[model samples]
Structure formats: structure tokens, C-alpha cells
Target: MVLIKDVGSEKDKKLSVSEYIKLLNNSLSNLYGEVIGEISEITISAKGHVYFVLKDKITGYVLPCTIWETNYLLNGIDMEIGMEILIKGRPEFYGPFGKLSFITKNVELVGDGALKKAYEKLKEKLEKEGLFDNSRKKTLPLFPKKIAVITSNYGAVIHDFTNNLRKSGFQIKILDCRVEGSESGPELALSVRALRGEDIDLLVIIRGGGSIQSLAGFNNEALVREIANFPTPVIIGVGHHEDVTLASLVADASESTPSLTAELIGRSWEKAEQSVDNIQRKIFSHYEYSLERSSKILRLTFEKAKKSFDKILKIHDNTKQSLRHGMQKIKEKIKETQNGVSDKKIYITQQFQKSIDEVNNKCLFNIPKFILKKYTKIIKDKQDSLKTLKKLIETNNPERQLELGY
Candidate 1:
């Protein structure tokens, strides 16, 4: 049993061993920070938890540290007996073992050389697993309308990205988080997982430029795998031109700057607009050409039609003049025939009258009465035949037929 002051009860209380350890652990949680030293001894349990001893080289001081399997694996560093490392965590007393241990939540290599060695080692391992293969990468949507962004809210990274993004017609969902430091890796992984069931077209993780150490969170093994296997296509734009993080390598698309990422998202839309403009111009040009050609064809057709009409009218006038001339000649011929018939009738009457007077004188003086009677009868019959001939001529005349409206 142990006697301790209980803050909740505001009194001194007797606590069992388990309760005492719990209270100590609760207090130790507040003493969390980073610790750096050389690794002296390392062990891995069956459950994959890492137990390591860190020693200060100059002072020869040592501290025992333990990291859970999840955090150990996420840091992407294979512990060796003599390598230097930095662990960020708090001290906790293990009730079963009766030992105080530094519980590491995160771990990283200590120096630039060590970090580079670890980075290269992890890069080789992931490359062998085909996580960096182009075939495994997803394609960015041609027209992404909804985007989920994971980045630090307390910096210019988000602002640069948003400012460069297109102004309208995009639904951006941002998860504000730390982009550096020990907590950033897990937070980024969680942020990605949080958007698992979300309705988004794309995922973007970005951060401003940083040193290799500051960008170590982007190289987290868990975060790399998360981006590599993400359901939606992912784009990572972290660090400067000189930096390329593991997260960027495994992502479907990578950019050197957050502004560049925004440009890539809006590139397709810009191209589509240009294509539309080109098509519009083509359509207008085609229409103008067709209209001009049709106008020319219409003009030629109208000219042909007018010439044809004029020719027909001229031929019609010529036919009318010929018909008029022919009708006048026919009328003159009919009038001349009528005049000749009248003259012939007059001459025949005069000759017949003379013949009758001569007959009367010769026959009456020298012939008997019977002979005179026979001559009179013959002359009267001749006169009657002459009158019948004149009547037949009058009935068959063209002038008389015309007068009867034939």
C-alpha cells in the first residue's frame, strides 16, 4: 500500500500497488518529449514490440526504452545495436515487471547520415515490394470535382494550394493536421483513413519545403502504404525540388510544390475549355464557307432562270407577229375572190340578155307557132338553171359562213 494525495478527492488516500502505478503513469504522460542517444541493446518480442537501451556516449548514462509494434514498424527504421536514434515518448512503470520504461510513440534516426541510410534502406525495401511501381499507381480522374486534402493548417502550405486552385466548381475537404514532427505521421495516416468512406474524387497530401529531418514524417512506412493503397487517386506535393519523400514516391502523382498540384488538378479543365473554343471556331468557319457557297449557287441559278424566261418571251412575240401577218393575208385573199365572183356574174347576165333578144327576133318571124313555143320553153329553163347556180354559190361563200359565226 502507498499513501498519496488524490487530486480528484482533495485528500490523502491509501492506494494499492496497481493504483499507485496507474497514478505514476498518468503523471509520467505529462513528461513526454524527445530523447536522443546511441542504441546499446535491442530486442523484439513475439508480439513485435521493440525493447531497446539508449546510452549517452559522453556521460555513459543509459535509459531503457520500449515502443509498440505499430509505432516501431511505422518509423521504418531497423534497430541495430550501435546505431544512434531519437525516440519521442514518455516514461511508464510496468506493473507486472516492476520496471520503469520509456514508452516510445515515435522513433527516428539521429543524424543526417543515419537518416539517409534508413531512407535508402526503406526505399529499397518498398521498391522491391512494388509499391513504387508505375503499374500499381492509380490514374488521376480526368475531371475531379471533389477533393480531400490532408496537410498542416498552421502554415502556408494550405494557403498556397488553395490560392492556386481554381475558384469555382470544386468541393475541397481539408483535414488540418501537423505536417512535421513525430505526431504528424500517425495523424496523416488517420486523416487518410478518415476519408475512407467519403465521397471524394481525389486525395491530396501537401506540405511546404523542409529539410530531410523535417520531412521524415512523409517517409513514414505506414503513411506510404496508406497512400499507395488508397481507394482514390492520391497526389503528394511535399518539400522542395531537392526533396522526394517516400509518400510522394508511392503516390499516384507527385509534384514539387503545392501550387503545382493545384495546377495539375485544373489542367484538364483548362484543356477542355481550349478544345471547346477550337471546335466553336471550326464550326463557325464551316458555316461561313457553306453559306457563301450556297449564295453563289443561288445567284447563278437565278441568272439562268431569268435568261431562260427572256428567251421564251422573245420566241412568243415572234410567233404572234407571224400569226398576225398570216391572218391578214387570208382575209385579203377571201375579199379578192368575192370581188371576182361579182364581176363574172354581171358579164354573164349581160351576154344572156343579148342572146335572148336575138332569139326572139329570128324565131318569131320565120317559124310556126309550135316552133316558137318550144324556143320559149328552152330559154325559160336556161334562165332558171342560171338562178340555181347563183344561189348555190351564195350559200357556199366563206364570207357568208363568217357572218353566221362559223
Candidate 2:
């Protein structure tokens, strides 16, 4: 709606750039003076302002562009090299430079599809210089005792964050602020600056679900730069499934929603308990196998002793036949003596059984019961670990598992 007035430089009405700008402002009394298009060509000059072209129909025609230092100050765009943009401005003339141009008041970035070429050109320049390396990313703390949240206090984001973390026994301090649209950039930068407190563990930047335009505040250069340079790792929960901003890339971890971010923090604690339980299962399984093997070896030794007693009885029978018939009575007495020896063999067998019983009493019964106490303690420990894993899996609530997908 910006009116391009006919301020032709003729006769006594000479004008300076500042004076001309004032006249232009007066002539256009806030009729929403400019409507920036969705796509345009952007450029820069040595005089610290942006120059661009706004072409709608791809015809053999071009529109002049100009954005002064004040406009640039109010709306700070880092102006990536060869970036495509959409611009709106009021037409004006520079008397000294004798150049006619549009004084840009608003800008839009349309950097994909027909807009994609210039976007790729600028992205390549920054990427080749190593601006997007995974190694540059920071690690999130596992057990952050003190959490700092940056989000709107009156909304669902703060409610979701506080409820989840507080229920899980975390101490948090929230730095409440606006987080969307035209005015969000400066406020977010200010909120991040206030987190210079030393007691902070992890910082969470969050917002509830919002439109793409509403989410633009987070994509601003100042906000993104602040996130990249933050001391602690930042957790971004911008809450729009489709909008992944520059801030998302620079953050330590980005969550789709505030509730999901809180759950992630909760999962870390559960995983620690799961680790301890896994180790317990391994140790318990080893001891159980050892006890079973020892019992098998004891049973095999008892069977070997019974076989040796039978072989001794067969040798006794063979020796009696070797005796001559000359001394029949003497042979009879020797047979009786052998019978006595056989009776004594029965006594010896009884003694062997007594000794076996004693050994069994001391080893298999008394000592095994003592060792069983240790094994039983191990069993209890393993059981505790199993219970922990169950709790962890249940709390996470995997959707596939609920569908019985194993």
C-alpha cells in the first residue's frame, strides 16, 4: 500500500536524503504502506543497506530496491551470501546519487522450490566453512539437578515442563518470556542472557504449538547466535511438527513438544537403573551354572565307588578255588576265615557309607546351605534388576509394543 509519490527534483524544492525520507513517511500515513511478496532477488551495497528486486510474474521487468540503515537496524537479517528474499518498500529518489529505488520496509525469505537455488548457493558457502559440523554440537547432561526453562509462563509449555520434571523430582527455575512472531527475537535474546547464573545445569527453550509465522521469532539471527554460544547445552521444544528453524539445528537437542522434552529427561534416569540391572543378570547366571556342575560331579564319584566294591568280591571268589584239597579241615577253616573277612568287608562298606554320610552332612548340607544364602542374596538382587527394567519399559510406553508387535 506504499504510495510512490511524484517528488520530481525541480525548482526550489531541493531535498536531502533524511529530508526526503521524512516527506515519504508523511505522505504514507500507515496504510500498511508496503506488501512484501513471497519471493524476490536480494543484494547488498557498500553504503550499509540492502538492495533487492521484487518480481512477481517472471516477466522482462524489474523493480528497484533500497533498505536504509534504520530499517536494517530494526529488522536484522545477516544476509547470507546470494540468498533469495521477498521485499516491500516505498518508491523514492536519491538526489545526490540521482538513483530511483524503493525504500524497503519489510522482508521475507522464500528459500526453497523456485526459491531454492539461491538458498543452496548461500548454504554451500556457509557449510564449506564448517558451520554445520556434528562435532561442534554439545552434549546434554544426564542428571541435571537444576534446570532453567525459557518459555511463556501462562501457557501449556510451562505447565507441561514443571509438572513432568517436578513429578520426577527435579529442581527447576523458569525465566518466563514471549516466544513467537514479530517481537519474540529480542525477548528471547534477553532471556538467554539472564541465564548467566552459575548454579544452572541444563537450559530448556520451549513454546506451545504455533503457526509458522508465529514461530519466526525463534528463527531470528540474534536468537540463533545466542543459542550457539550458550555455555550449557540448550534443549529446544518449539512445539510445531513442521517448523524446524535455524535455532533447532544449533541446539544440543530438539524435541517436538515440551511434554516430549520432559519425558526425554525422565528416560535418562531410567536408563541408568537398567544398566545396573543388566550387569546383575550376567553374574547370577554364572553362579547358577557352577552349582549345578558341582552336584553332577559328586553323583558320578559315588557310582564309581560302588563298581570298585563289586570287582573286589569277584577276586575273593577266584582265590578260594586256588586252595588244594590236601588239608580239607584247614581249607574249611580258611573258608570260614574268608567268610569272616567277607563279614569285615560288610563292616568296611558300612564305614564307607558313614564317611560318605558325614561328608554329605558337612559339604552338601551345611556348607551348601551357607553358599545357598549367598546365591539366594544374588537371586534377590537379580530380581530387583528385572523389576527395574520392567518399570523403565512400561514408563516409556512404546506404541508398537501396545499394538502387540513384540
Candidate 3:
């Protein structure tokens, strides 16, 4: 539905050299195509325009070429004098110098050999600077909460990357840009710069597999250095098969496909989950073991306490029985002592009564006998005296007195 304008198609019109050249230049803009040649001479102007000689390998012919600064940067290829390359643009005649030259709109290394040479050259240079060293790589976060993705939005790379993430809560922000073609390197670099100060755990640049020329943006030195110096760890998923881009070498992590890039991030989450599960299982096992041990100790302590209590109870019973026996024996000994004391008291009383009765009888019989003997002697003396008196009285009275005096 859209119409295009052709500037130099009117060949029959009369025109001046300047006007014809301007017309020719306008026509050349419409005559866009590509040329393949080996670079023999090249120079970059102070303004960043590249002027080079493209030599025909077979014919030994050559063409002078000029690339505008912006277009030179878009391809991001560092061209060497001997390198073969494909330049896409049109032929133009300059009015001031009256010269014919190829004006390049885009540039690419022509074959795998050139690509390899470029890759090796850059690899060696960066390696010498330690950009590809493992010590320079940042360890990826275990669980990234915020992520920045740099890729073309029109492709399946974003879809695959987003679909493959396994974590529950992740803030994925996309900076859509060209991932192939002339401006891929500069645009990708711009995207990286835009994300530099962002609070992101990771910066991911993903692209599908491509030919060496198609994937040359990943090998761009500027983009590679941008990735190497990124504040966040960079994950480059920009190739397929065994191809390794310079960006991959310099990145913190690299994978072959978008799916693999996603898997790399998801694996961290999976591993973290597995670790937590293992720790949980360990804690549970230790708790069970401690509970079992504590139960065993409690049972043992109860048994020991029960045995000690039973022993004390038995000792108390023995002591109680011993005390009862001692009290009974003391009571019996007291009763026996009381009975012996009563018997001794009765015997002593009987002996004392017998002695007192005997003493009383002996005193009564002896006192009466002595009094009767004393009375009897005195009576005999009185009778003798009376008889003598009677005799004296008879003699004095007659002869009986003399006989009685003798």
C-alpha cells in the first residue's frame, strides 16, 4: 500500500555535473546490495568514519569503501587489514572529488575463518586482561528476587526465558532491543547501561542460536566489556551447539539456549529448596533422637527412684519391728523384776515377826521365875529365925531352952 520514490531514474533530462552526481547519489541509495572482499587497507577518521580498500581475492581488483561512524559502530566488528568481510551498502559518486566509492551501511565478517580469527583475537586480548578469569566472575545469587532481561522482544527468547522460571516471586523486567543485525551490539550495550544502576540481582541477555555472522554482536568487544563490568552478575545465553561467544566467556554464567538460561536460574531455586528440605529432615531426626533419649533417661531415673524408695520403706519396716521387739522385751523384764521384789518383801516380813514373838516369850518366863526364887529364899530365912526364938523361950521357961541354944 506504500509508494517509494526513485530519484535518478530520469536519464533523458539534461543536468550539470553537480546535479548529475547528486542524482547519481540519490539513485545509489536505491541500489542497495552487498559486496564480499578482503580488506587490504583501512583507516578510521577522527570523526569515526571508516575508509577501507576491499580487494577481490581472485581477480586482484579492489574497491574503495567508506562507512559512516554510526554504521561502523552498529556492526561493532574490529576489521583487520587481511580480514575478509561483507559490506552492505550502495555505490555513490562524490561531487567535490569526482570520485566513486562504496558507502557501507552495515558490515560483517564474511566467513567462519574470519569469525574465528576475530573471536580468537578478542579472546586473547581480554584474557590477557583477566576479563575471562574465574576470579572475576561474580557468584550468582541463590534466589534472585529481581531480574533484568535484555533481548529482542519479537522472538521466543523472552517467552522461553519467562516460561522456564520456577520460582514463585520474581520481578522480571525486560529491556527490549535488537538482538541481531547491525545495531544489536550498540542497542544491547545501551540496554545493559540502562540496567546498571537498577536494583537487580541478575542481568540476563538471551538470544536464539544463529550463524557466526548472525551472532557476531555477542562477540563485540564493547558489549563484552559491558557485560564484564556489569554490577550484577550476567548470564549470556546466545548460542547453540558448541559455539562459544566472547560474551559467554566473560559473563558470570553462560548457556546455549534460552531454555537453558532459564534452567540455570531455576536450578538455584530447586537446589535451595532441596537444601532446606534436607535441613528440615536433619532437624526432625535430631529432635526425634533427643526425645527418645530423654524418655529413656526419665524411665531409668524413675526406676532408680522407685528402687531407692522401696529400699527405704523396707529399712523403715525393719526399724519399726526392732523398736517394737525392744519395747516388749523391756516390759517383760520389768514385770519379772517386780515379782522378785514382792517375794523378797514377804520373806523379810515373816522373819522379823518370828524374831519379835520369840523375844517376848523369853522375857515373860525368865522374869517370873527369878521373882519366885527370891521370895522362896526370904521365906526360908524367916522360918529358921522363928524356930530359934521358940527354943530360947522354952529353955528359959524350963530345960527346953538349953537344948535349943546348942
Candidate 4:
């Protein structure tokens, strides 16, 4: 499907100057590496491209290097003579000028002293510009549900972040890109820009810990500016605890590790969950107390009604004994009076029997019915109150609201 050109096969082949230069550049492309040296001379074109001469610190050998304006600005390093630096790129030959130049893709300060100086300089400048001001920082949402993550897809950083995150029904979108090396700065910036206008609640950029040199991409001026100006709140978790990148400084929030970043994002949700649990417990406790109190009231009411019923039954029995004694005395009187008092005695007996029947029906049927009706109404009222309370709890339940698509 493809042909491989074996340019080295014909060592004796004649070629034009341009052709030879092209082949030379092709060969030089494969010779890319990082070169550390001291900057001997530096200049900037009107178009912002950088031209510098790097001399080997040990051998005194000098090599010319050029970096495009975009790449130069992204590194955000100030070039000066006598400063040690590292450049990563390949050599290119200019046919017209008959010159060989190292085209740099990335540049970094070499020594700790140089790196610290550059870092402080940029940090001071950006700080003075109010880039790191707390007032300028946006607040992360209290309960962020939609998150956009920018990180390299290759390493354990992503896995660490995901594993540390709680299962809070978050919507995560990941943008995989290079997180190290010369090309990483532009790639990160581009990734941030690409996420603009996305339907996300928060933007997170994370990576594992590394030295200042290895984490240079996060110090990129362009990436820092992009993060500062991002529409959504930006969170950066990169480098070690002691190494704070410029991009992290400008972000809305910053953390030392990817796991910490995930924790920060889930904090509000976790708190909310705890709060809900507490409320639910309180509600259940209150409901139980209410139920127990209602039960006690019902028991007290039943005892009081039972005592009243027993007193009424005793009075009915005493009244019946008095009537029976009076009827016996009247009967004895009637027999002594004979024929004249027969009708009177019969009437008296009928009246006494009717009164006994009324007392029996009232005590055995009406009294019990009244007590049962009153207790039944009390029970119904208690049940209705419990139903209302249950409804109120359900209406205010956050989980129930979510289930109903709130």
C-alpha cells in the first residue's frame, strides 16, 4: 500500500543543491533530541520568531537555533546571554542561505537557579497583572454534575482521578492529549479552547507529579491565559506539592494531585448526601416519637373509658336490687289487701319490668357503642395525622424529588 524511499541506497547519485538539502533535512529529522547549552546570542524578529546561538558549556561549540513565535511565547522564558537552556528540535537546512539551523519546538531553562528565576519572574508579572487575585477567581459550583477533564489518556493519572471520585452520578467528559514534552503546551491550550461552550459545569485539568522541567507545559503563558479566561470554572491539579505551575495559579482552583482534585469536585455532593441522611434519621426519629405518644394516649383513653363503664354497671345493679325489694314488699301488701289491689299490682310489675329492660339495653348496647365510636374516631384522627405527616416528609424528600425528575 505504501512505498519506502531508500535515499541512502545511492551514495554516488548526483542531485541538485535543493534536492541535496531536502535529503539532508530528511536525515536531520530523525536526529531530534534535547540539547543543553548556554545562550551566547539572542534576537527576536519583528514577526516574533526567535533566533539564538547556544554554545556548549563544556566544549565551547556553538549552534544556531530558531523557534517560531508561537512556540517561543508558549514557553514564556526570557532569553539572555550566559543563561543555560535546553532546546528540543531537529536541524533544518536553508538552501538559499546555505545554512543549517536547529528548529526548536520547545525551550526550557536548564539549571534549578535559572528555572527558579524564570518562574519567579513570570509569577511576579502575572500576579501584578491580577491574574492570581482571589477576587478574580471564579467559584466552583457547589454541586457540579457535569465535568470536563483534560489530561493525558496514557498514564495512571486518569485512573487515579476516576477511582478517587465518588459514584455521585456525575457526567464526565475526558479529552485525551499529551501532558508532557515540547508539544504538550499547545496541545493543552487547544484542548481547553476546544471545550469552550460545552455543556459542562466544571473544567478540570490534571496530571501526576513531576519536576519543574517535566511540568513545564503547565507553566506555559498561553495555557495560563486560556485557563484564566475560560468561561467555566477551571481546576488544575498538576505537579508535586511544592511545584505550583503558572496555569494552576491562574485557575479557579488548584490541587496537588489528581485524586485530590476529584475529592474537591465531589465534596459538595458528599456533604449534601450526609445532610440528607441526617435529615432522614431525624424525621424517622420524630415520626417514631409521635407514634409512641399517640399509642400512649390511646391506651390511657381506653383505661379511663373502662373505669367509667364499670362504675355505670355497678350503679345499674344497685338500682335493680332496690326495684326488686320494692316489688316484693308491694306484692306482700297486695296479697294482704286481696281482690281490690290486683290491677295495681300488675301495673306496678309491668312498669318495673320495662325500666329493667331499658337499663339492660343502655348498659349492654348504647354504652359500649358510644365508647367504640369515640375510640374509633380517635384512631381515625391519629391515622389521618400520620398520613399528613408522611405526605409532608415525602414532599420534602430530596431523593424522592430526584426520582420524580426534579
Best candidate per TM-score, number? 1
What TM-score would candidate 3 get against the native? 0.62
Identify the runs in model 2 with alpha carbons over 4 angstroms from their true place: 1-34, 38-43, 53-106, 110-127, 152-155, 167-199, 208-222, 239-244, 266-406
lDDT of residue 255 for candidate 3: 90
Model 4: how far residue 297 lies from native, Å: 2.1
Task: Residues 265-314, candidate 4: write the lDDT tens digits.
Answer: 99998999999999999999999999999999999999999999999999
Clashes of 1: 0
lDDT of 2 by residue, 4-57 (tens): 445585435556667766676566434334543423566666777777665545
Please give the range of 10 consecutive residues that has the lowest summed lDDT in model 3. Answer: 393-402
What TM-score goes with each of the models?
0.83, 0.46, 0.62, 0.73
Model 4, global lDDT: 0.83
Candidate 1: C-alpha lDDT: 0.87
lDDT per residue for candidate 3 within 203-262, as digits (tens), equals 999999987767877887778878888989999988744468888999999999899999
- In model 1, the runs with Cα more than 4 Å from the true position are 5-12, 154-156, 159-168, 181-183, 290-299, 346-383
Ranking by TM-score: 1, 4, 3, 2
Write the number of the candidate with greater lDDT, choosing between 2 and 3: 3
Per-residue CA lDDT of model 1 for 71-187, tens digit only, reads 876666788999998888899999999998999987878877887787888899999999999999998999999999998788788899999998659999998888885457777
Residue 269 accuracy (lDDT) in model 4: 88
Assess candidate 2 and give its lDDT.
0.66
